[model samples]
Target chain A: MQKVMMGNHALSWGAKLSRAEVIAAYPITPQTEVVELLSNMCADGSLKAEFIKVESEHSAMAASMGAAAAGARTFTATSSQGLALMHEVLHWATGARLPIVMGNINRAMAPPWTIWTEQTDSIAQRDTGWIQIYTSSIQEIMDSVIQAYKVAEQVYLPVMVVLDSFVLSHTNENCDIPDQDKVDAYLPRFENAYRLNTDKPAAFGGLTGPDWYYELRYKIEKDTERSLDLFEETGKEFGEMFGREYGLVETYKLDDADTVLVASASIASTARPAIDQLREEGHKVGLVRIRVFRPFPSELLRKLLAGRKKVLVIDRNISFGMSGAFYAETKAALYNEKKAPPMWGYIAGLGGRDVPLNVIRDMIEQTIAEEHPEGDIVWIGVKR
Target chain B: MLEIRFHGRGGQGTVVASKVLAFAVAREGRFVQTFPEYGVERRGAPVVAFTRIDDQKIYIRSKIYEPDHLLVLDPTLIGAIDVTEGLKPGGWIIINSDKPAKDFPQFAGFKVATVDATSIAVKHRLGSAAAPIVNSAIMGAFAKITGFVGIEAVREAVHELSPVKKDENVEAAQEAYDTAEVPKEQS
Candidate 1:
């Protein structure tokens, strides 16, 4: 049935539909509603799950890891500071091969203190061995949570379904909530062969010497790589059941375009109209929205952007001294290609500043007008 | 696409008003998006919310700059802020005021509609007499003035969304729909 709900509620509904066995979460702004609804569902007997109320985000992840270790489908959610606090356990969840699905609202990290939308928080965890999937809309948020669990359980690695804070979390949009029976058919119960069983008497997360530690790390890397294909297959199967199908990278009007704008999360959603406007004005512009950030989708990006006339990357998260994280990753992805286009990196909409269609248009127009990018990092709408 | 900007203070259900309207729009099988512009989020602080209704999916995730219409829940916000800052010239401005629509000469260029949402809300006991909740009443006036959403849809949305005073809120909306002073052409 179609319902108008905030993105946070969509996450709650996704967790409920997945029939998560355990929910461990700490409430934070934007993300508070996610846990609030889940708690209500748990209390009202709608979703029969053990809702664990933890002290902090760290404890939330720890409890989630414990539940997943015990062979339960565990779910948790946090934003900015909350996610940052879970950094240590985030690595542990992956290292232990627990398929815990977490919803991370991408809020900007605070020293100046903000609760608004930004990608830096999730981007900082790129090396945590968690599969990161950035979602743009409420429907994607709902669908990706279920898909994340399937892909995570298949590969035995945790998945972080990330979305921008207020842009997607607080916004109410129309979404077709998949029927419970249909969802059950699409994603069967998660059974972990490696789960901790008292009768089995197995040692878990025990200290490993130098001889086995390196191989353990390598196995995780290989499995993380293997999840790319697993994600694709699962997404296709999900599409067959549900109407909307998702991919690692979604392209808009790129078949015959000279200039393409690359972005992730809500920024990508905002760029579609700019691409359409530019196309109408006779500018051969298009958009490539990077849905999956962890597995990187490097091969797909390299293939799509190899021979373009110009490529402009808009990143909402900057890497301090270097460039935008996506900019660096995309450039690295295409470095060896002989026919790679002249790419430009732009940092915009950081700290939740609005990146409207006009700002996106300006970035594209600037990239198109210049022969080559004057600087490594082009900051848009920043006051000097 | 039709865009609407809602103006009200915090604790006045400004954001919920936008969501309720969007819910009504969505019930009619159209696409809709509604979200508030977040600040420090204190009670009585000026709150701004937006709703976009379109035939197709809305991909723009930015704040609405040039809204096609305005919904002003607090009439006192008229002088404090430009309630019609980015409103379209001929678009409707639905205000929750006891006075007639013509009383607001400042909005002469645009179509004006007024409903005593506070009185209606108080009469229905939706909230206290000092600070009555006026969102549903204003939404009723909006449905009456613009015909963007049907009164039935509004009633259904209010019935589903209102937490405590479900029947009272629905009655408030119906009363406002009956007595809202809209332009003759629009009426």
Candidate 2:
């Protein structure tokens, strides 16, 4: 109830209460504890579900897909390399329109094999069709899982509830976990119109020729676009029931503010304090935490960031040769808006480097205090 | 604003200490932030964490090189890192050591405060005499010196992480609080 829980633990609680029937995962740092809790719950008969101890993260997604395709509520989790391994099936899960929820702890991918924290792991998979949601706090981590199930089932698209590996994962905090009944009422079963079985076995992912390929692709694109609306409708419904409303994009104190921060995952948490500090010093700074990464919520963001000038987007991951992934997405979302904010991308923490509150504060200070016309990225929290 | 830097091993609870301290300050209705600039250094390597607390809000985004309050968890870090490099003028230093507060030369021009938090942790049967997680104890002295946060709030924050031994850490911290003395602020 009121106990201090790690972000991963909070997610497991949400999954179990959501009546998830199948859990398939392999142990990995930060994310391992989440699967471990589910395994224990299933072992003790507390959770009436089949726990599939998979061979690898790749198989974990495959098995979860099979479970969901077979009309059972399915969930899984991975981090860093583990998520990289699940790359193949993530597309399959989303392509097949299977509503599988995954809890991905955002860990830095390794070359020297680092395991501390970073956002490169999840951000690299931006093109993956799953609806990705990044969380700033443990409360949001738990709440996101519950919301993911509702939104995923509504539109039949998979959702990834993401959090910083250790920042929100290992760092325990006070979270108001929703009651089981409230979640039960909010999220019903996965009664999709289509399920893969012998009784009514129909073609899923049937081959397409050039004549039908464009139409099939267009259908998927149209469904993806329609999902943003469904997400808002379900979010409003959730708000009415649980009093906690979430959106594809959340704007905090951005009204009449010239500079607003755009961030997701734990950067949102760090930016919040910096925003408070800047505001106290009479600086008009606000925050936007992204809840949906895919179906990119372009319309929602266009409205929020429309008139605001000098927006700063903080990203933990980078696309290397290209722009910051989150910042690039922010630009795409705001491209059609009448009043587009000139976004400055700030890549602060990478490879699990420490991003302190001061770094966030300084970003606000720099964004508001001066105008940089040339620099595309200002990497903070690095030793100069 | 009270900016504190903690030096310890990776698992020594330095990061946690900074977080609990921030929450304690938050209990006073102030906005604060706590974070660690951890390295690949494992187990016993010198790890550094930072804390920012202000009456209004804190936005300075730098690893505190110049700290208003510098805390040393392991006395050995005094030689390894520049613990005194950024200490504010007329600021404070709280060290976990057996030596007298006056004996530390780096704090020569500052209001230095010292306490045997390790021994206090041992007396309270908290941990080994060698290294007891002295964050709460040092924070106890921190509370008494800078007056940024009260000991009660620290105790309450400790319960968030460690409930079973909350009172023990609180008592151990209070003991350090009692022994903590500012050597008549430097002239």
DockQ for every model, please.
Answer: 0.93, 0.16
lDDT to native, each model: 0.91, 0.78
Output per-candidate TM-scores for chain A, rounded to 2 decimals: 0.99, 0.95
> Which CAPRI category fits model 1?
high
lDDT of 2 by residue, B153-177 (tens): 8877766655357788778778877
lDDT for model 1 comes to 0.91
- Pairs clashing within candidate 2: A117-A352, A358-B60, A358-B61, A359-B61, B66-B86
Alpha-carbon runs more than 4 Å astray in model 2: A29-32, A36-49, A192-216, A241-243, A258-261, A272-287, A306-312, A333-346, A353-384, B1-5, B10-36, B49-71, B84-92, B108-111, B123-187
Q: lDDT at A106 for candidate 2? A: 86
What would the per-residue lDDT of candidate 2 be over residues A1-384, giving only the tens digit for each residue?
Answer: 444466778789879988999999887543558999999999999899999987789999999999998889998988999999989888888788899999988888888777767888887776778888887777778888888888788778888988887677765544566778778878877687788779886888888789987886676678778778877888788789777787777777888788989887777866776787788989888888887888787777788888887888888888887667888888877887778978888887887776778878888777876665356787876776
Tens-digit lDDT track of model 1 for B78-120: 9999888878888888888888888988887788888888888
Could you list the chain B TM-scores for each candidate?
0.96, 0.89
lDDT (tens digit, per residue) of candidate 1 on A1-384: 999988888899999999998999887553558999999999999999999988889999999999999999999999999999999999999999999999998889997889888899999999999999999999999999999998999889999999888899999999999999999999999778988898888999888999999999999999988988887888888899997898898899999999988999999998999889999999999889999998889999999999999998999998999999999999999999999998999999999999999999999999999999887989998897
Please estimate how well model 2 matches the true structure, expressed as its whole-model Cα lDDT.
Answer: 0.78
The numbered model that scores best in TM-score is: 1
Q: Considering the two chains of model 2, state its CAPRI-style docking category.
A: incorrect
